[model samples]
Target chain A: MKCPQEFVFAANYLADMARSRSLEFFRGEIGAEVKADTSLVTIADRSVETMMRDAIREWFPDHGIVGEEFPVHNPDAEYQWVLDPIDGTYRFAAGHPQFGTLIALARHRKPILGVIDIPAMDERWSGAHGWPTVHIRQGRRSEVRTRSCTAVKDATVFFCSGIMWRNDPMAVWNGMHGVNRLLDGDSYSYGLLSSGFADVIVDSGMKPWDFMPIVPIIEGAGGRVTDWQGMPLTLDSGIEVVALGDPALLDDVLRRVSAA
Target chain B: MKCPQEFVFAANYLADMARSRSLEFFRGEIGAEVKADTSLVTIADRSVETMMRDAIREWFPDHGIVGEEFPVHNPDAEYQWVLDPIDGTYRFAAGHPQFGTLIALARHRKPILGVIDIPAMDERWSGAHGWPTVHIRQGRRSEVRTRSCTAVKDATVFFCSGIMWRNDPMAVWNGMHGVNRLLDGDSYSYGLLSSGFADVIVDSGMKPWDFMPIVPIIEGAGGRVTDWQGMPLTLDSGIEVVALGDPALLDDVLRRVSAA
Candidate 1:
């Protein structure tokens, strides 16, 4: 299934809007409030999401919208735009540059276009169903693909945070012993994987806005993303997410993850 | 105990030399090798250290030099320079921008002047004895200070990695539950601490070159850095290290770390 060119253009435009709005609050004193879930939220997140949502409605009224800061709209529509206006709000609140805006155009619940925009770093990764993953850094665009690492032992893994895994934490920690495990990076980890700088990313407790935008980018880069049980991610998929730059390592990674 | 003006000037010159050389290999392919200690090293690390060492020797012939890649030179000299040309090799090898060059000038074994140069990000933080810490980004220099957060539970902590603690992992892991713990950033984390972006940084298994350069920067910003046992870090200090943006949190942080 080919992704619509218009959707890709819209995603890039939406990301631009998000980058401009979010930069205003970054590094400045933001009025950050603790959400019900204990995660931090700032006015920047709401403002960026609202700006993107309004643009989406004005340009494509029939398109649905799902954002982190607001209620879902047009849930039953064929084309749905998923937005995490500010992913890694914790990093953002801490004045870290790894936070990004995620935008995905899902066609009938399957993502076909995705964008990961790191505003502070001026880096962005965009991919669609039928196109190669493209990384743009400082306005230089180039195609990128995942590197091959068939064995899990030799892989460089990015595990977001150990505490996020509510289930058997020790098992998960021990499973990554032989590998080079970096315990940082949120959505930026996926972009690194797509660019072949990282081999795997294991994270849990993700939302639709978190995981959906990455599926297309990872798949388009010849990588794979799935639930812990090895199922494709959807709007209704479970939160335990595993992404592998080399698709062949899926079974080996899943085996270790299942043991955890 | 004021830092010598000449030493501060020399340290900044060395950092500039490292920045130009390290940026050449960053985000580009280089021959990376695994050391006997299982840490990764590259030509960039060796080259940057060699370049800095040469400049240090030429500028101050009597000064001693200690670096990660090579053996100590003039180890008994009154003035000694400690260097870690590439502080976060894993991130650098993975094309991540958080890696930095650490430089410190110690007088009679006490670090009086220090610099943390992040070449890829074009950011540097420098501090000296009796001087406020200064941060430079894109040629803009500003004096930075640590924000006050005295409580352990309310602090935003940056723990480098979990697996580095060989003695007891679970205890340390559980010790950080109530705080907002971020598991990334190497030397960059310390810079963020000095700039008031983070509250605490806890890590283990650090050598002199790793911990020396961070002391003055943290201390000058009105923060504290010490061994896990609450002792000031010296050339012979233990590898277990902890830093706090607010000095009032030292007792509380050490209590938790000791329990771990």
Candidate 2:
């Protein structure tokens, strides 16, 4: 199934914006302004989101927009674009090179395309529904897929500590007993999971913008991404989610976490 | 008090040998050999450890040698040299460029000096007891310090998955929740905490070589490195450890995890 041309074009354009932002950030001229929540924000986040939102308005005026820095542009539209201008802002602010800009396109309440651009790291990942995922590194593009490691004992779990688990924590903890390790970061964890470095990623307390872009990227890489209850992720959902290279492991994790 | 001249010379020579090994593994000519545990153990691990161990035997005959690859020599000596030939072996094998060689000196059952060398990444970190910690990035040396973020809520927490936390999942999981985010890899995470980019790193199930080099490095950077109960990190404990910028936060984390 071919994705709409606009999705491809917009994703590429966003990647270009990320490159420029990364260059500016490393040049050490701009300061990171603190938001009320004490998390750092920068001019790049605002500028990139503005550029992306403007392009969406011009090319798909009927589509909606939801971003970390901005309110909804058209909350009722069937087609929407979600943007996390800088997903690893803390890492970025601290001069670490693990941050990325995330974007995803949804059609009729489902994500059809996604992009994660880490310009400083010189890596880019893009995918659309039903199409093979692609990674661009050092000006070369290659297909991407998650590894199908079956046993929890062999699995490397990527996790972030900020979110609370409503469940008992014992089952998830027990299931984790089988894991090799757990990493953190919301979308970046998905990036690594899709790249075959990790098998499972569990996260909680996500907004639509935080998760929508990651679903297609992992799904396109031959993995399953769903809410904690094992429900498929949708553009409207704001729930806990787990992405896994194998579907059976996802079930195992869910059973363990639910039991906990 | 100034560190002994012999200790500095020995560490520098070992660091040089470690660099050569890292270069070989990263350059990819020899290729990595997988260990029985499924982790990669390349020729670099063997070659570097051999070079360092040989030097210690010839130059410091009375000292014990505890390393990643070889059996301990003179294990009952008053001074021991601990080694991790290549700390992030997985990253080195996969060409991730974040791996480092770890070397530590312990006298009278306590770490006296530590050195972490990552030749591929062009970074070096070293410290001696009562001496200033130093970070050399791209060949420039700067004094390193722990980050000033004192509260657990305000602190950035890092963990190396459930590998270290397997013994007490609830304690580890709950301790993880006490920090801001969870990052991985004992070698690199400890380096980041010492450099002030992160605060509060905890690891369980660590080997002597894995945890020894990190103790002096973090403590010399004005942070505390101790077992989960806030005691000092001695050699080969294979127990849980916590490294924090503030003593109060460390106590809080230990209390939370112990209760869990």
Report the number of the highest-TM-score candidate.
Answer: 1
TM-score of chain B of each: 0.93, 0.89
- Candidate 1 residue spans exceeding 4 A from truth: A29-40, A162-164, B29-40, B162-164
Candidate 1 TM-score, C-alpha based? 0.93
Interface RMSD, Å, model 1 = 5.0
lDDT of 1 by residue, B166-204 (tens): 655657767888887776647888998888888888888
Q: Write the per-residue lDDT of candidate 2 for residues B1-260, one digit (tens) a residue.
A: 45576796779778977787568656353332221124345466787788888888899999999987878889899889998888776545444556788898888767888898877667788888878888887667888877666567767776665443365554565656644554454676687778777677767767777778887788889888888776787785646778776556777778865666
Mind giving the per-residue lDDT tens digits that candidate 2 earns over A1-260? Answer: 56787678777886786568655854243422221123235566787778778878987889899899889889788778888888776656544556778888887778888998876667788888878888886688888887777776766676554343544443454557745544454666677677666677777778777788888888899999888788888876866888887777876778755665
RMSD of each: 2.9, 4.8
CA-lDDT, candidates in order: 0.84, 0.72
What is each model's TM-score for chain A? 0.94, 0.89
Error of 2 at A108 (Å): 2.2
Q: What's the TM for chain B in candidate 1?
A: 0.93
Docking quality of model 1: it rates as acceptable
